[model samples]
Target: MYECAVLSVYVDLALGLAVTFLLLSLLVSGLNEAFVRLLSIRSKFLWAYLRDTLDGADDRTGAWLPAGVLDVFRVLPFLRDPRPRHSDRPAPAQPSAVPDPGERAGDSMINLLYERVREIDHGKRGRTSISDIPPARFAVAVMELVTAGGDVDDFLTRLRQIDSPLYGPLKGVWESAQRDLDRFTKGVETWFDGEMQRLSTLYKRYVTWVVAVLGVVVTLLFSMDGLEYAKTLLRDNAYRASVTAVAEAGPEAYAELRARCAGQEPVACVTETLSQPALVGMLDQALVSLSIPDQGAPSVHWNGGRWWDRVTTPAHWPGFLLTYVALLFGAPFWWDVLRRITGIKAKR
Candidate 1:
């Protein structure tokens, strides 16, 4: 019986952590959406990479790709060039008859790159390369925009000077571009694909940082202390009973919410789950258990209005930091932990 009592305390701690993590995830996602709207941070990375790829090359030839090629990469959101739409380039005329050999020679290197790939006999069943289609077509189109006005080097230099994350790890590729344009173009394609993979990891890092900062702010705002709250729940049988009841009912609600929010992109899914009124009400009920006057609200700040004293207390620092760091582990993690605990409780 004593062992069960101690175990219940641990379960309550996990439940608290799960609730906080969900809140943190929503905060981070909201911040990301705001950043995207304000700065176009996501698209800027692609543009900077494109600039770096075209760095240092001058187009002495007056050749340009057909205006239709500009639309080649429109299907890909990441590769889409945002600069050209805002640039002062004059509108191009529609494609007429095919140009003679000399006129085609003056086309952009990127234009030729696409042409080379198109000339390949796919009947040989050769594996697709970045230059092959879709990606290659998109790359060439964006490259034309990045290198427009023969200012590839200047464009990337400006992006680098601005110190954006979009200029990530492309110094070597740009340096190589100075020596061999073909190799530079290929490296750019490779780097773009590689960066696409890295983008996922980078986004998580941003969210982790956002969650940590937001966790600290929230803890300060609510005067939350993980350790003190745990102790309070353990000492008060009524409070623990209320929490247990809520937790016991959480599994089915969570499962239903999960099913409803499944198949969405990460940001959208988290936003949807966090916004659900049913889930929000469940969390509110659990919080009520912690703050009810008869239950002797776990933290004194709940009853006493000494917000500064609660915020400045040294003993709460460790618990505050613990919550902040746990937030970095993210909501899905705590949700799974709570789910396992609930499963064990169900069996018993």
Candidate 2:
């Protein structure tokens, strides 16, 4: 027969770990995003491909069209800036938040190419530039950018100059569409769609690696001796009970927090909640209940020796494994598990 009290304690311990992993996931995600932006990997790849595709002839002057295609959000006004707006005036330093620039921009390289092509074909249509070009008309815009009253041979010559390794796979696609100018633009768009999908896969893998690295760093910073923490959770009845209460209360609190951040779709809610003081306080409270240190403490008790001990101790393996590896699954998985477990507990 299983002891009901022991089961309840274990359940709570699991929930507490879930909460910890969720918070770590958020932190990891934010750091990874910053890292990606700092390197400008996505934008660089996008711009490089656009430049190579449009100015493949190495014609710096003719590359104007591809060089001017702006970012999607900047081009489309109705889409709106999903992030919160802040004033230009300096404010008190707070949690790390990405800088948000409100609406104001010029043509992206693609849009620039569109504008130049449109100018050559029909002259100024109005005050509007290629940034205002609709998605459906993108292929049309590309066709104009490439042809612009020129022969198919000239168009192919410009495209041939794009020898970048990233464009290697699309070479065949481009070659097939070259003979037919009308189909060329459509083919290019199709190729771009495929490349975007590839990029999406690549980025997800990068984010996963970043999350794992950050997880380890976070655990170390907290002096989170997984083995000792596990022992406390299992042996100290009062501590386990307190952590269990917090775990039971967490989901409802999280739901309320999500409601408060109600804005655009998924991303807006996540960003807003992450920046909120209430959410931070709740996480801090939960961490305290679980006897986890968040910020660095003055005492040097939890140093290299404790870390070494945790790694060597056979008994601590379960808790250590959970703490280190849980983050690889990401926060959503753990949250889902917590919800299912709580639901079962409630039913009983």
Candidate 3:
């Protein structure tokens, strides 16, 4: 009977910890999403990939393609500024002398292909740039641009005229296609898919650092001392039981919150979910139960003491680090773990 009682306590403690981590994970994820959107990180990476692929150089200097090609690409009809120009402002004067079309045919062709691939939608709010383009659409756009209102023969001839680093690979794709337009389009699609896969890998690597920073910030802000919290859960029967009860009902609560937050922006969704009376009450109880003296202060505080002692709280560092690392695993992962733990508890 004593062993069974101890097992029950341990299970309840695990449930409480799982619930805490799950909630923290959700907050971190929503904040991270909002930050990513605000900074346009995905859009920037997409632009960098496009620039590197089209110009054969990631930098603005343009190793194979001419400088300013990416700038011109950004100004294409489908990609130009989205904000409406003020009607009161005078229109810019057009130059009388036109430059030779041959001078910028390569740049123009690249821009045309991009414009076709990602045509602007009239219904949605206008966006200056896009974060993604379908590989199949990109392939079709390339074929259409090279054909130039002519047949497959024109596409073949124009393909040869491509003066950039893309010429050699495109030629290989052409040969693999046996000069068939459909086969050529499929080859291009495959090529673009491979490049996009690489881009996705690079984006994940970059986002990892961003997530780490956000995790540290969140850990410090909440004073989440994982070790201290665990110790409290082990010692305090009433608190553990209360938190475990909440954890047992967590799935239904999460489902309701998810339904309430559907279609909302990440920041707004987090705000709305956290503002729920039940959630607020739970968090209040948790704050008191956890014995966190200053509700809003970070782990490191300016206590009224000597300058060195005031800001030095090395004791919380290990727990803070552990919490930060856990947060970096992301919300979906914690949610899955929470579900599994809940299932385990049910089985017992």
Candidate 4:
């Protein structure tokens, strides 16, 4: 009986910690998504990738293009500054002379292809930057550019004369197509898909770092100490039991919430999940019960005060770091663990 009671205490402690981590994960995820969207990180990265691919540069410096080549693309309305300008502010002065057409001639093919792709993807909708382009659409744009008012042979000859890094690979793709337009379009789509997969992997790595930084920031902001919280739950049986009971009822609601959020962007999905009244209320209640200083309290100043003291204390670092690491595994991970623990508890 003593062993069973001990096991029950440990299980309840686990449930409480899982719930705490889950709430923190949700907070961090929402903030990260919002930050990424507000800055248009994905769109910026895609724009850069497209530029590098077209210019045949290994990096963003675009050294392959002649001076003033990019200026032509920059002037396009869709490529202009995305930030809203103030009506009261004066317009910037225009350049004294038009960019020499000869200087931009080498980039014309890429420029035309980009414009065609933009028309197909965005249509009448204004877009400052394209966040995504379907492979099929990209293939269509390339084919239209190559075949418009000319034969493939003439286009390939002109492509060879251009000073772009894309010449070699594009030539290979064209040769492999064996003069069949359908085959060439399919090959272009395959090439686009491959490049996008690489970009996606790179973006995922970038997001991982973003999430890690956000985790640490959120942990510090909340004064969340994993070690301290665990000790509190272990010693305070009533508090642990109450938190665990609340968490036990969470999985069903969480599953429903996830179902409803399916296929939405991260920002939208997280916003919906965090805005749920019942979830917010439960999290608030649990956080209020914790020993950490409340954000709304006057003593919680960050620069200097009891809060700083709490932060600077050597013993608190371990807990803070622990919570930060836990958050890196993400909300979905903690949610799965919560569901499993709840199931086990029910069986007992």
**Highest TM-score against the true fold, candidate:** 4
Ordered by TM-score, highest first, the candidates read: 4, 3, 2, 1
Query: Per-residue alpha-carbon lDDT of model 2 for 172-201, expressed as tens digits?
Result: 655787656556666766766765665456
Give residue 337's error in model 4 in angstroms. 0.9
Please identify model 2 stretches exceeding 4 Å from their true place.
1-6, 48-141, 149-153, 161-183, 238-321, 344-348
Tell me the lDDT of candidate 4. Answer: 0.62
Task: Quote model 1's TM-score.
Answer: 0.45
Q: What TM-score fits each model? A: 0.45, 0.50, 0.64, 0.66
Give the per-residue lDDT digits (tens) of candidate 4, residues 56-83.
4534434321223234233222343322
What C-alpha lDDT, on a 0 to 100 scale, does residue 132 get in candidate 1? 20
Instruction: Give the winner by lDDT: 2 or 3.
Output: 3
Per-residue lDDT over 290-314 for candidate 1, one digit per residue giving the tens place of the 0 to 100 score: 3223345454223234556666789
Better of 2 and 3 by TM-score: 3
Q: What is the alpha-carbon lDDT for the whole of candidate 2?
A: 0.47
- Name the better of 1 and 4 by TM-score: 4
Error of 1 at 200 (Å): 5.3
CA deviation > 4 Å runs, candidate 3: 58-102, 105-110, 120-127, 149-162, 238-311, 344-348
**Lowest lDDT 10-mer window, candidate 1?**
61-70
